[model samples]
Target: MSQATPTSQSQNVQTVTIEREMNEYGALTVHVDGQNATRHIVEYASDELKTILRQLPSGSSVPLTIEPIGTRGNAWRATSLTQ
Candidate 1:
């Protein structure tokens, strides 16, 4: 009999700052330094992180740890966020 081993996906975490945008839909985006100018979306941010982000004023440069989603090299989601 042959058995298959399960593998876990590695997490890619990076510290970055939020780049707030002014529009109807309040979306969160961050730009990682030394990389392309593509804006990453914080789609899967935690509640605590989301609350902290929401309180911050526009154009705020707060450091945060973000994890990129599947296949999205430029897209990101906050894992650990602090003001």
Candidate 2:
């Protein structure tokens, strides 16, 4: 019998500045080094992240990491939200 080998893949994490909420759907518009990036604010977002967004006004700049999830990698999740 042949043993199956496991393959490792590295995920790319992107840091961007929060621009504003895209809509009521929990999506946030952000800028990655001045380029607009649309990131979805997952329902399971950390309390810290929600607090930060609540306190900050629209257009206020804040650092956050956006990453892809699931097998299709079509969806994104926000993380590491910081000032």
Candidate 3:
């Protein structure tokens, strides 16, 4: 038997940019751009994005996901990039 995969328009897109900032709670403000990026917020932040910042090249685009953690905040989690 053969299996099929679910279709999702929000998959496989790569990051165009990522930035980190801080708020009163010491949260990370991450700005990421990707395919159909306009569908998302202007910019968001997360602890995960803070983890991967130095590892990534300045101005290098990476693959990530927009994760929502309720009251905590939203974050950009890097999984992969164009390379």
Best by TM-score: 1
Whole-model Cα lDDT of every candidate shown, in order = 0.55, 0.55, 0.41
Write one digit per residue (lDDT tens) for candidate 3, span 2-48. Answer: 53332343343445563543334434334446343422222334455
lDDT of 2 by residue, 1-83 (tens): 55333222323355555567545565665666555556555532486665566566666666665556554534655556644
- List where candidate 2 sits over 4 angstroms from the true fold: 1-15, 34-36, 71-74
Candidate 3 C-alpha error for residue 27, in Å: 5.9
> Is candidate 2 or 3 superior in TM-score?
2
**Where does model 1 exceed 4 Å of error?**
1-15, 22-26, 33-36
The global Cα lDDT (0 to 1) of model 1 is: 0.55
- Identify the superior model by lDDT, candidate 1 or candidate 3: 1
What does candidate 2 score in Cα RMSD to the true structure?
A: 6.5
The CA lDDT at 3 in model 3 is 32
Instruction: Name the candidate, 1 or 3, with the larger TM-score value.
Output: 1
What does candidate 1's lDDT look like per residue over 1-83, in tens digits? 55333223434444445567523354666655556654555454466666766676655665565555655366556666544
Report clash pairs, candidate 3.
63-80
